[model samples]
Target: MATSNQGYIASELARNDFQNTYDLLVRACASHPERMAFSCGDSHLSFAELARQADALARYLRHGLGLQPGDRLALQLPNSLQYPIATFAALQAGLVLVNTNPQYTAAEARHQFRDSGARAILVLDRLLPLVRAVQADTAIEHILLTSVDDMENPRYDGDEPGTQRFMQALRIGAELPPVEPVAGLERLALLQYTGGTTGVSKGAMLSHYNLLANIIQTLELFGKPGLLEPATDVRIAPLPLYHIMAFATNCLGSVGMGLHTVLIRDGRNLDEIIEAMLRHPFTLLTGINTLFVGLMNHPRFGEVDFSHLKWVTAGGAALNDEVARRWKQLTGAPIREGFGLTETSPVVTTSTSISPHRDGYIGLPLIETELRTVDDDGHDVAPEQPGELWVRGPQVMQGYWQRPEDSAQALTADGWLKTGDIAVLDAEGFVKIVDRKKDMILVSGFNVYPNEIEDTVMCHPGVRECVAIGVPDARKGEAVKLYVSLKDTALDAEALIAHCRQFLTGYKVPSFVEVLDDLPKSSVGKLLRRELRDRARAEVG
Candidate 1:
């Protein structure tokens, strides 16, 4: 498949026929009824069972709880069987899904639910305290709760007063009449909120068509019959499903392809993750650079087998070429890197192979995806020049919910979504990310990208994790500052700077290097450059 200014989709790729995401689910169930659909903690749910349970819960939400079409339902749970079931059920019930991070604090939870105007929420039982603190601040009327073992061993009890067990909902919902389908595929299906690193998180309104398009585009690479083979390949799902990458790929795309997904309860639990890898001769993997680095650094990483591994997918952050090289070297499977954001249904471009990926470039846009790199004047930049990446596709969100001004600034009248990432198209037509537009450093009138500095730092065997941010500089206007956590204590900041000098230019080298116990990261393991930048500014003040 190739891209150009003409047809948005590559001529080689054919659009699949489907009503929407729900339709995709129904088809998967019908085709692979007896196949294992999901598994966690020695428990397995087949396609037939998943469909049955989701239908039951959907009926309960529609009739049993008096929920109506277009009502928003928040899903605030970790990676578990209940998450998939409840999400599909909510879809069948014609309720919009608000995928909430289970790690969210009360304040963050309040912002999402209140902003979405969610009427109901499905939460993990242990995390009910956050719900209690935020429920009063939201429009939440129905509370559905579940435990880690709710599917394996049903739990009927909770401390919260107005809550019901998720297992109980399944049992009751099983007896209700089948839920009717929502009228339009263009209707809103999900309210995926941004990470709020730069500012307040705004919900990007995604419709059923939006989701379906993303699923189809991604599936062209993952689904069909061979790549991520249905009912055969066991995929290791470590990233939180709430994140659009995991949500669109693992939760929907993988499962819709009829693959068995093993959810990692906590991505930080390297022991459990490695054990899961050993338990299932997993054929597929999905993760960001942080997750990949963590796994390979684990003491028992070499113990887990990669014999059955077909390939690995990386996204959610810039993939360090060094990290990709190491991962491929260790696993014997090449890492195909991709790039996207929450606004674009999370996938704007993906690599169909590892050729261009090893060069530290994000691959071509998905089928029918149009990309333009423009300067401040909205004019296209020359090849090998850096500019803001603008995207237009079926997968792009309609707009940020209820924020017309912010939405207007993000999207163009002609439909391009302004991705604030500075990128360049190499002579080979490969796209390489320079850095986030906000994180670019200006040193003596030269633009400096943190990703380059960080990638260079990560090449060091001593470094475990690192981030680069622009800090106040009296001489240069702004300087590059790097914060790192080390795997080798013998390595020091001075040594790191010296190492960077070997690869990076004088201006691009980090002016300041600080080694700490650990660097800050988001719940999904993406580095928090915004947090580091704020702290540096405060320190200067």
Candidate 2:
């Protein structure tokens, strides 16, 4: 018998645990077809309905649209009943999923769709204007449209060239001949585009094996009983379903575990999230640092029932200590913070409970995962010292899609993927994410991490949110400049600086402060430091 210490081998697990990504659905349908699988607003889809719909859509994608095996399909819809249906259908039909950001502008959308050479796209009807704006620039040959109102009919009834309603397509597909599942789990399943914050976004090539490894790894770490309570546990999916965190845990993991998932179309809407929690009393909540801060800060935060919450996992950004402590104090549920990137199938280290509490705590590496930190000399760093974190795991992505040179730069010959984030591993095997190596600032020969400054700044009561970035300085080479959004009290720049001085050293204190109504954020709500850096460069220019 294979012991748990050996961890999971994706190839063997594919043969034993489950067959493929779509197989998760197949098992769920067979076990409990009448149970609610997915819920959006007032509408719910049972496992049986989901199976019928996904198969129909899969047939339509294969035969009707002529999307052959290995073709790329861009999913531009938000968190709705349509997303899960499209996801499984595309996979079953042997198409690679290009998870597009629904909030993207025409230029961004065009860049992704054209770069991936996507042959078809499923977009929202309200975003038909965007499709009209960029359809000429891409390889998109067919359009499957859906609306928020009708699960069947799109709002854009106009016969735009190549446009068809998604539900109607599914209905038509049901009458077509059934298609066979693709062979091998090694085939590419998703082209997850990342690095948009740092530079030109490139698609990380994730095979079915990579996603399946993560799905099982997460279950292994936080499985059974109190954490993943099988059929009774309801997941409040406020994060966009397209994002790796929600996609792996909320969509795939939930379906695999027979858990009901409530999808929130707009996670930024605090009222909507609260209302969903009140209605369903969710046991799972997958969110980031900013969202936790926002929800706890909301006036009606106290109204939502926390009795049913068993898991509140944070990722996509570093978790602030203040926010974490406050969340636990209020909800009685510790936010199990994890860390990963799209390249690693979006999970590497996760914390269930930090026995020894520490800031930047991201627990241990997942099963069958190896982690290392190296200095600038490319040698392993001493324990408790900060260095670039590298990961080698079963879940690591195969490579970047169609960018061989870029892929080589990211993945070493031995299969180690350079994470580019600074981290420290304690003697106890605990991990702490110090900050991004690229985001570090140099102040008069001293290293200053923006996360440290921002974390300290966030301790103030009046500071709602803040982002710290380095700016050009004649004296210090690079000076720390802070941008903040206020919540309560009339604290000015000098007052906030004084507050910081009490906790931080002179060099770490902000040289300038700009109070803004809102700071730019990515679709996943991570603070966009690259955008801030660009703004600073433009200001100096």
Candidate 3:
């Protein structure tokens, strides 16, 4: 296995036999039918059982819903057994899966549905109103809603009705007709949206080959065989499923290895998570810097048992030195940070789980991924020099869905994905992210693109122009701060903040709103975010 300082080259792990993601899942299921595949709370499913359910769901989609393989199906659910089942089922049925944040507003939901050309949606009942609001304007032909406790052990008050309905759907057993398998590795399997250079969320077209290749590369890195027993090795998954990090690491990675995944449905439920950790003795825990920091600062964090812990992987944002030190002290395990974008099937380079280096560096590239830091002119830079990181590997996404021009801009002529992240490749091949080339803010591991905030704020009657910049913060690693020039003097900072809360998610809402007579701009009238960021830093200092 040829490896790099970053880890392993993805080219070495890339398989020519597997055509798509569905084929990979089918292969895994066939090879490990009796292995434990998934767990959500007390509910568990074996590989055989999961495969059956996926086949059943695929049948329902084809026969009952009349959805074709290429049709898009949006999934708005948390981390659960159903998520994987639905995802694989969609792939098996030859449909493209579009993942949406369950907490998205009607506006956000509508934009994604319209952009992805989603013909159907499988969502949670709690988020039905948001979907309904957007469904009218979307190409959505069918809506399937699930209850919160659908797969829980004991029947809560919420479980009975939806479970009964779901059971009825299963009992009907609609025979699905045979569907042809499309082996276009470059064809889209997922429409993963990210806040692009322009700030508007654009779908990254991840083909079946892209996703499957990532899974293969990831599994090769693990080098572990057999199911990870729940009694011995459990994985803590507090992150949301919508994010590619959680999707790849927790959902797909866990399933591929037959590892038991304990889903923290709500990350805010810190006490419950700690308690569960104490009870289950989780060996591997993965999350962002803020999550680990919050846990270490929690009053009861000291009481939790970390004796059985083996590995902790952090990503989605930069890991602070202080946070990493405190986490290591509390858990007796170093928090290994990594670098990746949603466009790269999420995992490009990660630190070793067995022998982690505690120097705040995202360890080596995986088996078949290539990492190179390039200067402004696309020339490779020297080691330790900060430049835009260019990744070339199987994990890289195919292109942006329906946006050929955007795709052309993102991918280099030599097939490398131009990750707009400023990073340095050390002498040993370890990659350390220094900054972002794009104006994007990381709030609690969520990507809050400046353009999204600017657009939302500009809609306010009082706001003339606004610039959103990331400001250094002690807790969240970075906070969203808005510098706005008001059209009406009567529009105050407090009022603007209040208005934004209605339109944006809590993380996307700016923590600090500064009222200004004018915003800094270039000669061409482009908002200068760097100037605002510098001004904010100077003021804080």
Candidate 4:
């Protein structure tokens, strides 16, 4: 028998609760073959259809495309029926899935493809040009393209050179011999890239066991009233599949739980998201502070029936107290906030229905998870003291892809993954995130590294030097604000912002641009981001 103690699961239970992800998928299919597994727009796929399609695509990827076991496959498609189809198929084909941001620029996509040495990619038809632009710089050999209209129409119409329609590939795959599931859960499953503290992007090498453990941990905490059980719940997936939060929850966890997840391709469109919610009346809803606020503010938001919403979980960014309170006030459902990183399979601590929602605290650690706060000297900090948060669990990532040095720096010798966020642990074992040790800006629950933003801004010939910092934003929680020292005095803020937009994603682009004589710097000539942030706050005040 195992008992919960101090927000940690018993050691015996932790060691024995082991299941391979692929095995779990097979079990799910066997248990509920006809259960609706996924929904995107008007197209829905049952567990049987998903299994068949994935196997077909897996066969095509292995035999048709010559993709060998352990080969990396980049999935740059948005949230849709095709995403899960490609994801499970790649796993079945014994390929490492590289979860790439669909909104990434050509340069951003190139760096990931080059670093991972991906042999193949599945991208949206509209984004085919982006892949082609970066094709010369990477080892990509095969391109599988899908369109928004592909699922409903079942068409094979495409004229791209050296590329084939994804639907057609699936058809061909169904005729070929079935690909067997890869053995062993220790094999690499995903290369989920995240912005590093050192300002470079690194892929977190997550194995099948890591993801499986996390899914189990999440279910142990949140599994109640069959919220995730097959054919019992409908979960609204407004988050992108590429992100770790949504990846672990909707794409992997919910599937095993037998949940019918409605995928939203473009979550940014508030109207479309609202319409989907109205149509589905989902029981499980997950989002960040921004989305919760945006929906509550929408004119037609009050029209939707939220009586069916079982829970609303917020992650990827800090939850504002006001936002949480407002959501509860409106929907009678408290917003349960959790915390995690890309390295930990993206789930560490989450507030369950059994726990009380304390302001600013991220709640207890999941089952089989251990967390502690350590001072700069690596000594454990006392309760109520803020320090660097360290985590140890089966869900923790193996390491960064091909970067031993970075991996060594992030993980301790004894195996604790050093989470860069500052946190405080209470006597009750509940965790509260105080602040981020790194200067990464989280805009609308998306990581917008300041270094990446400043680098792109400096590329403008008119900018001599620039500094990017996160400023408090009403809607996004925090937004990027850039200050520039101009090479050409006539260079205006509008032009520089436009230049950044060309390279950065929509959220990474600066909301406010200010022209300054020179940026504040330390005696050694390092830009003082703290000083700029303080000045911005003072000006705002």
TM-score of 2: 0.80
Model 3 weakest lDDT span, ten residues long:
155-164
Cα distance off (Å), candidate 4, residue 260 = 1.2
What's the true lDDT of residue 306 in model 1?
Answer: 90
Q: In model 3, state the lDDT of residue 329.
A: 78
- Backbone clashes per model, in order? 2, 0, 14, 1
Q: Write the per-residue lDDT of candidate 4 for residues 1-541, one digit (tens) a residue.
A: 1115433333423454433456656767888889898998899999889989999999999999999989999999889999988888988888999999989988889999999999999998899989999999999999999988689987686788899899999989999987888866789999999996556889999998888878777767666654444466788999999999998888898886788899998888888789898999688888988898889999998898989776788999888999888888899877889999999998999885556567778888887788889998899988999999999888899999999999999998878999888999988788999888888889988888988988888788889999888888878989889999989998998898789889887888999998999988999999999899889978877
Off by over 4 Å in 2: 1-4, 11-17, 152-158, 196-198, 224-226, 353-359, 440-541
- Higher-ranked by TM-score: 2 or 4: 4
TM-score of 4: 0.95
The better-scoring model by lDDT among 2 and 4 is: 4
At residue 402, give the lDDT of candidate 4: 97
How well is each residue in 365-477 modelled by candidate 3, as lDDT tens digits? 87678888999999989899999999988778878888899989999787899898998888878888888898888888888988888888999988899999999887787
> How would the candidate models be sorted by lDDT, starting from the highest?
4, 2, 1, 3
- Pick out the ten consecutive residues of candidate 1 with the lowest summed lDDT: 7-16
Off by over 4 Å in 1: 1-17, 157-159, 195-198, 223-226, 353-358, 439-541
lDDT of 2 by residue, 176-211 (tens): 999777756889999988652234568999998888
Steric clash pairs (candidate 2): none
C-alpha positional error of residue 278 in candidate 2 after TM-score superposition, expressed in Å: 1.1
- Per-residue C-alpha lDDT of model 1 across residues 1-541, encoded as one tens digit per residue: 2354444333322344454467767888778789998888778888788888889999999988999989999998888888888878887777999999776656668888999999999988888887988788899999998888787788866666889888888888888888866656688999998733343668999988888778767766554444655656899998788878888888887666788999988766878899999899898888876678778889999998898888888877556677788888998988888888888887988874433353677887776787888999999998888999888888899998888988998999999988888998766567888867766565533446677677778999999999888876643456788999999999988999999877665766898888889888889988888889989989998
